[model samples]
Target: MAAEPVRIDDPADPRIAGFVSIRERDLTGREGLFIAEGTVVLRMLGQAQARANGFAAEAILLLESRLAGIAEVLAAFPPEVPVYIASQAVFDAIAGFNMHRGVLALGRKPSAQVGASLLGRLPGTSLVLAGCGLSNHDNVGSIFRNAAAFGADAVFLDETSCDPLYRKAIRVSVGSVLTVPFSRAMAGEAMLRGLAEAGFEIWGLSPRGQVSVAAIPPARRIALVLGTEGEGLPEHILASFRTARIPQRPGLDSLNVATASGIALYQIALAMGRVA
Candidate 1:
């Protein structure tokens, strides 16, 4: 396949608009598009491409000199996807940061059905469902990555949680975001009820909780409930299920949500003999 590269000299070129103000509200808020940086993430995105599921690659931006190599990497993509080449300086200007590897791509958000169906298929599964106030994308991504790596069956995000596909979350997950199945729960109450109805024993992770996480018995299916950094789970939500906390040192307040998730997931996996 011949590599066709379009030279973009002007930063303001309307064709490259997706690459602008990625950190600001213009692109994220208005268009709901987030930027993914580095070659590894871009490659992950390419590998996870699905045809029937609204997978659309808008553009690929690369350094002028690296165009050939990038073209080779992108050879799998159809001809309709635009490939843009720019000088390192121009690429930096457009990306609003140093172009780490001179490669980036614009991808559409997968539909909510993708997540919903992914969760529904896994019956009697142990998983993580992030609740309200956990807004950090990196933390959310890390939790997802750990969930997948540690053998958690799926993930569910509450209404207040950040988008798992957000660029920062995706990058932090090291692209594990694509591998892990996830869905959104409109309210914390609904999430808890659904998991209970699905026959999962819900375990809430909190610092002040009475029972240690290790005490929770291994079950056929479990749902680990994780809340935000400072506020923890609301009273009503806490009252809805059994609460468990990671044992910690005398002075330390608590573990970060992601770290707490990893420990809890490891324990569950170990109990099931899934981890050696």
Candidate 2:
């Protein structure tokens, strides 16, 4: 059965109530959902249907000009999922930005349990722990994409990290965030203890380090901890974990957190014999 397409010109349409971010309304308690934009992301969403089963998805919103092509893809969805169409101007106004690809979709948020169980399933090797307050969605997305491409087992975020499922993060990750298994650590001391109990050797990435990243010993299980830009890791967390540094030409300040994460993830993967 073909998915129904709904056409709307008004930005105030109630059907898209969740798409609009209202500041006055506190959404902190609301169950979080993921918004994905662009055809690339939509396609990935369709491909990941099995993993995303519990997560409900909104209809694909597209410009009328792109309706026909998008319809072919929407056919993969159940008939109950609507496909919304709007004029380019109306789409831009409703989306609050120039949606160059004229496509957006909302996916149901994964439960914390789903993320927590990931650690038990990972083949003992290396993982990337996002410890910083990565408030930037783009950076969070890029980190997940890199973690997936570099063969990292899982991506773990500290309590202060950004929402990986945010629209910007999903778009930047090209939807790879949906496929990557991740969980949030409770907080400082507990997070460290949980990792230790899990048999993961936590290695903090910082400029002031006793060992170079290249010198990290091959371990059965490893977790690479990354800090936010500018602030870096907290001194307490630094004191808690063994530290490692990336070798660079003197005078260079530091690599962007995402770039540093990619290099570190790749190196760890290689060292653990998980990747070439």
Candidate 3:
């Protein structure tokens, strides 16, 4: 059953401290917790909690007017999870902005797992996305969205990559960050080597790649390695891994990493029999 809302009279209420000034704290905030905003994201968070895969909703804050609309969503979560409601003024003050969507959730990040450990656990047949120096949160989110769309088993990130759980990234991904399994590795090279050791055929995506993405054959396991936007996959990585290109026109230098990921994932997924 959906828990009855507890009205929040004060914007500075101690019970809702975690939600204060979300914009400022998003830049430098606590690690174990993340804000899940919007009805879609909150719904995904509820789904994540149902999975019980090391994720939980610490609390939910809503504009008093929105409680009725999200009743189904609230019902998905356990009654023990507190639901806090606030008037427009209090909600705006607490969030540091006019939160039009008015649906927000504090979700606990799952326990950390080492990159190699996560890679080692995947089944023999798997498709994965490996990101190197992908600092853009939106790109990170899109990558996970693409991975999930293409049925990738997991995503691996290097230390230089941005956290997918960043508020904007999570919204950009429409909550795929919470759904996809991901881990951060110490180094890009170490991540690639670990995937290789796990019997994953690693393919680095680069404009200068030797083969076209469509030409690449199927494999038992494949990891599509993506790099940052302008300065693409490092030369060393390009040299080390078998690379594939998207085959674009002469005027264009390269596709955005996120767009490139989606295209590559689609093609590779088809080859790997993950999609029709």
Candidate 4:
């Protein structure tokens, strides 16, 4: 069983400091720490911790009323991980918002090398998502949700891509950001080059791609590169790699980058026999 939830009536309790003003700290530049809200995400964090995926819950703050419902999830964390409970007013005060979900957690990211090491260890036959200049957290989160849905082996974000661990991004992903193995912080060109060198058949996604996504032949390792919205893929990137387009109606310019990623990843995953 998880340890009994510690009752904290004070919003300024130093132990719960991480839970204060959560909205302002969503960027989580605090040495790889992040806030996880809602039962679903807390559950995913538990799974990541259980699997030793290099993530762990440092503490959890919840409204006293939510204690019973989330007890199962709290049990997943080690007893040493503090679980703080507060009255609704105190919880709201600590979170700096209404906190309708009545749940919040402080989670620490894995080691820095976790993402960088994914490439060298992927199996010979695999499919991965390569993102370039994906500046939107919602899109990044959606891409991860899709990556997990389609069984993409991993996700690689170029230096310009937003951190998938950002608060809104993680929430938008419904915790898929924790579930999916991903690496970020490298130049666009170099990220793709590393994939190419790793034997991946890099395919860029664009509204004006050279071929239909279905036409792209199957390969042992495929890297589907998605770009930012509005501008789409960089000119240099489109020029350098094979590209695929999702056929669409005449009026619309293109699907949202996140939506497009789902369709493209589904096609590639299906072609690779990863999805039925």
Candidate 5:
């Protein structure tokens, strides 16, 4: 079992600095660290840590009242990971709000994997998602959640996509961001090139797509590319790759990127027999 929880009555404690003013410091504080909030996300972090899947908990700050209910999830962490408890008042003070979920973890992101390296790791018969210029956190998170639901083997985000590790994204994903393997930081064109070179049959999603996503021709590997919500996929990308549409009703320009991703992933996954 993990060690007993340490109590931190003071909100200013340096040991818990990573948890302070969390919302305001999201992009700045804790260099490469992220806050995993709620019981579900924390449990995923614990599983990753236990499996040595590249992410680990640095410390967890819990509301004192939540201890009994959360004990089993906390036990999944190794003993070396510290667990701290604070009264509701102190927890609220440190978090800069009332953290009703009452569980938070300071997690370290894995070492960066090069985009090409991530692509190379996919299985020969893989189904993956490739995102370009997807700047919305909720969209990215929902995409990841959809990926996990549909049995996508991995996800790749281009340079302009927002970090999926962002607090809101991770939470919105219901922690699927932790479970799904992903890579980011490549230029949009380079990312597509890498996928193509890796033997993936690339299909970009668009309202004007010539083929329906479900009717996509069989391929050993598939990469479904999604773009940011409003502009949809770039014109050049559409022209360069085989593009597919969801067959939406006319006059409706398009679906939300996240929602579009789910429909596309589900249809593709069904075709590939990746999902029942």
Candidate 6:
């Protein structure tokens, strides 16, 4: 059983300070920490803790009535992790808004690893998701979700890409951002170059791709390159890398980046025997 939760009658209490004014704080950076919301996400936080993968939950805050329902999830964390509970009035006041769901967690981001170092550690047979100039947090999170669902070994984001751990992004991803291992490349092209040098067959996804995703042959190591939703991949990337498209009815501009990622990852993952 999980330890009994501590009651917080004051929104200003220092122990629960990290969770105060959540919406406002989300607009600013979390400074190496992030808020995990909802039961599914909290469960993911618990799982991340279990893996000892460098992520840790510093504390959890719940609406007073939510504790019983989440007792099973709470039990997953170690005894030392504090669980704080508050009434609706106190929780809403602390959050600066109506706090309906009531499930929240403060989790620290893992230590950073350089792109080359992370890629070098991957096994010979691997699949990865590479993002270039992707600015949307939801897209970033969804990419990680697709990566996890399709068994992509890791995700690499260019410096221009948004942080996958952004709260809205994390919630939209259903917690995949916490589960998928990822690294950021300070120079986008340099990251791709390193992957290419590491023997990964990099395929850029574009609307004007020469081959349909279904037609691409399997490879021992592969990386799928994706870009922003409307602009798509850069010309230089398209010109240089082998590119693939998801065949669709003509006339629409393109698929949403998240949708395209799911479809593409599903196809490539199946071809590589990563998915059944």
Alpha-carbon deviation at 231 in model 4, angstroms: 0.5
Off by over 4 Å in 5: 114-116
Q: Which stretches in model 3 have alpha-carbon errors above 4 Å?
A: 114-116
lDDT of 5 at 44: 93
True-structure RMSD for candidate 3: 1.2
| Residue lDDT tens for model 2, 120-155 | 777755565656666677789899889888867778
Compared with the true structure, what per-residue lDDT tens digits does model 5 show for residues 7-40? 9989999999889999989966457799899999
Q: Write the per-residue lDDT of candidate 3 for residues 7-124, one digit (tens) a residue.
A: 9999989989989999999999687999999999899888888987667899999999999998999998998899999999999999999899999999898887533467677888
Scored by lDDT, model 3 comes in at: 0.90
- For each candidate in turn, the TM-score is 0.88, 0.88, 0.97, 0.97, 0.97, 0.96
lDDT of each: 0.76, 0.76, 0.90, 0.91, 0.90, 0.89
lDDT (C-alpha) at residue 141 in model 6: 80
State the weakest 10-residue window (summed lDDT) of model 4.
23-32
Question: In model 3, what are the clashing residue pairs, if there are any?
Answer: none
Query: Model 1: residues >4 Å from true position, as ranges?
Result: 1-3, 26-32, 50-55, 68-72
Worst 10 residues of 1 by lDDT: 25-34
Decoy 5 TM-score against native:
0.97
lDDT of 4 at 170: 87
Which model is ahead, 3 or 6, in terms of TM-score?
3
Model 4 bad stretches (over 4 Å)? none
Model 5's alpha-carbon lDDT is: 0.90
Question: What's the lDDT of the predicted structure labeled candidate 4?
Answer: 0.91
Residue 40 error, candidate 6, Å: 0.5
